[model samples]
Target: MQREDALRSIDVAVLAGGLGTRIRGVLGDTPKVLAPVAGRAFLAHLLDYLARHGAQRAVLCLGHLADRVTAWLAQGDSHHAIDVVCQVEPRPLGTAGALRFVRGELRTAHVLVVNGDTFLDADLRAFVASHRLSGAEASVLCVEVEDATRFGRVEIGADGRVLRFAEKSPGPGTINAGVYLFSAAFLDRVAASDAASLERDVLERLPPGMLHAVVTRARFVDIGTPESLAAAAEVIGEGTP
Candidate 1:
């Protein structure tokens, strides 16, 4: 399928429900996505990236400071005008739970998912096409970094099949890019939990071939900590990814 066609057909689901516990003390009352970066909300950058890739709609799963994110979207964005749907979580739901909450609203059999706090400038079309061609139910966008200490490593075979998830380490390794293309059936396997990690509970258990990986060299910046948030502008710069 054409890249433009793929974007229109697939819906985006962003996980922005976390409390931002690590940075909340510094950025009081602000949701992680609302964190200022390069003079604008970080989410604006993410939305722009999606818009550039031809994504037309999104489902934002929000909880902590949910109103803030929604209000930002409600004010109306003139730049990247994609249709937005906000799914407010009654309580904190883990990554997997939040995605599950929007099950019916996703509308598509598969949806592109990303972490609101992380900016992974990957090629959306290639990521989607990779999953389509691999015949896998799920695929994680992976990127190689000089140090995998920040995020645990994801071992992927030469065929792009996920082998195992390794613990954090100081040395260089491949890690999840915090982006994914997941099938509805694969997400349905998650039977509701107080808080479940999409990685630990689901993806990690899938058979080698059932889950795949798409590697990219796009810049990756996550604003999980105050330090990272401060450094984001330098990494992302003033241009769109």
Candidate 2:
């Protein structure tokens, strides 16, 4: 699709509500999305990336210290067209539950979902296009990591459809890169009354041969811990993938 067409086609929903328990000490008092990396709020970098990739409208799912997140984003005027949606979970409602909270705000047939803590240099436009072309209900952006044991590994079929999703296993396989392209139909499947996890509740519940995984040639970084945060800062500073 053309750039303009793509820009008008997709809406982005960033999962920024996490408590960031792992990085709280280093980030003290600031929402994890506001943590500085390469001299800018991490959320700015994420929004900039999304805007460049043709995301016309973006929503930020916020929790814990949400006001700070809003204030920070408002100050920068980053991605001027972005829309911020605050999802305050009284109790921790796993990933899918958080998503379900904002189901009504999703305006597109497909939405691009990204974890606020992980940054991956994947071609999001192509990712969405691939999903549009494929008949799968959901497509996860995956990468081959050296330590698959730390993150859940997803197995894909010869045709690029997800066959199995293994959580933090010792063996080597493709790991979820914290990004996903999901059809609007997936929203209907989310239960409204209770907290649910995307991995454990939704993904695992999908019928066999439905969920697909796409391997991307992109650099992935998880900024949830001090060490990884430093690494992301270095990568951003050096301008290297």
Candidate 3:
């Protein structure tokens, strides 16, 4: 399929249910995804990004303070015209569990799973194309960083297959950008219950070469902490990706 058609055919699931423990001091009662960035709620920016890429449907997997997020969407603050659906998790499910919980709401063959607090200004079209070409069960967005201490490393082979997930260490290496593209069949294999982690339980245990890694030199940001949150506006507000 063409890039636009591919993007339109895929659904976006933003995992926004995490408790912002690290940034609680900075944004006391605010949900992490609602933290202000560039004069707009961070979730708004994420929806805008999806709209720009021709995504027509987005299923928000919310957990903590899901009502607030639903209320925000009800206010029609998002500039994009994309159809948005809110799926509130009954309890705190890890990233993998969240997807399994909302699998019925996903209406596409491929789903672009994105972390609510992280942003990667990479080429979505190319990423999708690579995933399609690789024929892997899932694809991960990887970026090279000077320091991989904050984020753990994602070891990938020369052929672009994810080899292993390494522990966080202070050194220059490639890291998972917290963005992923998974085929519906892949998600169907996950257990329907239990709070399983996306990193430890799912991706880490995937067979070697089963997962594709789409590495990019894109500008990336994870606003999980106060320091990164403070720098998000500057990086995300810069030029278009």
* Best-first order by lDDT: 3, 1, 2
Candidate 1 lDDT tens digits, 91-172: 8778889887887788888888899999977668888888899998888999988877889999878898988898888988
Residue pair clashes in candidate 3: none
lDDT of residue 84 for candidate 3: 90
Give one digit per residue, the lDDT tens place, for model 2 in 1-241: 7543554676777888888999999999998888888888888888777776667787777777888987776686474455556556666667887788777888888888889888887666667778778887788889877667778878788888878887677765688888888888776667453547787777776776788777875777888888889889765564422
Candidate 2 ranges beyond 4 A from true positions: 2-7, 77-80, 170-172, 191-195, 238-241
Winner of 2 and 3 under TM-score: 3
Cα deviation of 208, candidate 2, in Å: 2.6
Candidate 3's residue-wise lDDT over 144-218, tens digit each? 888889998998999999889989899889999988999888878864545378878888988888899999998
Clashing pairs in 2: 162-212
Of models 1 and 3, which has the larger TM-score?
3
- Which lDDT value does model 3 have at 93? 83
